[model samples]
Structures are given as C-alpha cells and as structure tokens.
Target: MPSKPLTTYVTHQPMTAVQVLEKAAEIVAERYFHGDVFCSAKATKDFLTFKMGGYEREVFAVMLLDSQHSMIEFRELFFGSIDAASVYPREVVKVGLEVNAAAIILAHNHPSGVPEPSQSDKRITSQLKDALALVDIRVLDHIVVGETCVSFAERGLI
Candidate 1:
C-alpha cells in the first residue's frame, strides 16, 4: 500500500489591516490587500464610509496605506451593506486630513461572490480620486473583493 500522504494544516489568527498589508508589501512588488481594494484604498483617505445591508451583507473594512509608497496607517472606517452605501468624498478628505494621510487605497467586498467593478464603482472611484487629488491626496489603489479580488491600480483603472 502506498504510504499515506502527509497531511499539513496551517491555522492563521485574525490580523489587522496594517498587519495584512505589511506582509503583502514585503512579498508583492506592488501593493496588495486581502479584500476590496477600493474600500481599502479609501480607508487610507482622510475619511471612511461605512455602509451596511444592501449588497455585501456584513463586512467591516479599512484602507491600507503606504508613505510615499511606504506603509502608514490602516484606517478601518466603517461597517455596512454592500449593495447600497453612501460615499462622501468630502468626508473622506476630512478623515484623510485627520489622519494626515498622504495617499489612499480603497477596498470593499461583494457578498454575491463577484469581484468585478460596476460602472458606479468606476465612476465613484474616479470622482473620489479627483476630489482627493484637489486636496493633494493621492489615490493609490482601489480593490474589489469577492471569491477573488481585483485591483484598479493594477488594472490601470486608478
């Protein structure tokens, strides 16, 4: 009989956003985060929007950061429904100002398991990037999360 294949299991404790990105930054040549890159990127913006109960169901989020391409704060801004949520660029800037963030990353999830960006998603990111740019805030990346994830910066969407 063939020898039983070795079984290995690895358990990971929950990690904070900062912790997650720190690890990714170390390995990936480009910035990467676990969930919605838009929401993650946006969390790095001055303010964060938490929306609940329309689409994504229940998922808390934050925007990971880097200082002039270095790591800064991992700002967890809100909790809300995925399908519908309010995103205020002014408020985001306000939060970015409060945090003194130089750049931003955005991330959010799709509970329906599709990571594609909707037209609204692209429009909102463009609007936010334009809005934040006026205030000297750089929009680094926007990510969408589902069974898999996608990045706007990686796709040249940002």
Candidate 2:
C-alpha cells in the first residue's frame, strides 16, 4: 500500500489545558445549574468553587436568576490582580437588567487561597444589594472561593 499523508489522519486540533477546563466547567454548569432551582448553600458553594477555584487572579462573577430561582446566566464580570477585583454596583445592576434577572448570587475567587470574606467584600455586597434593590432584584448570597467556598448568607452576612 502507498504511504498516506499525515494530514489525512488529523481530524481536529487538540485542546489546550485551559480550553479543556473551560469545556468541563460548561458541562458542569449545564448539568447542575442551568434552569435548576436554588436548593442549598452547599450546592451553590460547590458550583462556585468549581467555576472559580482555579484562577490565579481575582474574578468577580454573578449568577443571574429568574423569579423562581432558576439560573438565568452565570457571568464573570470583572477581573483584577491576584489580591482584589473591583466590583461595581452599577455595572452589576446593568448586567442584571440586561438579563432581566429577578435575583443574583455573587461570587469571587481569592487567589490567596483564603475563603474568608474581607471587609471590602462585605461593603461591596451591601452596595450591590442596595443597587439591585432599586430595580427590585434580590441579592441571594455572596460566595468567596478559595481553598474552600464560604457563603455570606451562611455567616449571617447577607
């Protein structure tokens, strides 16, 4: 038999590590979050941890939800240095309005591997809650992702 060219054997390009992880996250989100009712803090924490835990820098994300608490969207809205991500209430509200979200769950990753909510986190959560309230959008919880996930609501902070 004649030797075939290598090009004929390659059907697709390989995925980078990041691409693989992104695809995996998408699969998990579709299976676990999309159109699913909010049931427990542990579930939320697990999802957020999976989504945000691997970042080397800070990322602020929002889980926009419907009136029935089904997920509308999960968006990473802000990026920052290894230590902090600037979260803007107005921008968050704009995203919420764009999605017509009835509620939101906030989440961020700490590159420092600490899951404790900082004072700044508390302040921004308050600001976001107030801003979202103006449009009748509820702020359900704020989660900090690090070595583990911490729920602000669980700590009576929300």
TM-score leader: 2
Write candidate 2's Cα lDDT for 1-158 as tens digits: 99987665657889876676678767766676645447677667777777888899999999999998888889999999999988889999999999899999999999999899999999999999999999999999999999998899889999
By lDDT, who's the top model here? 2
Summarize candidate 1's per-residue lDDT along 18-124 as a digit string, tens digits. Answer: 55555544443234433334344433322222121123463434353445444455544555574645566777778777777778777666677777888987997
**What C-alpha lDDT do the candidate models reach, one value each?**
0.61, 0.89
Clash totals in order: 36, 0
> How far is 81's C-alpha from truth in model 2 (Å)?
0.3
Error of 1 at 117 (Å): 0.3
- In model 2, the worst 10-residue window by lDDT is 28-37
Q: What is the lDDT of residue 98 in candidate 1?
A: 73
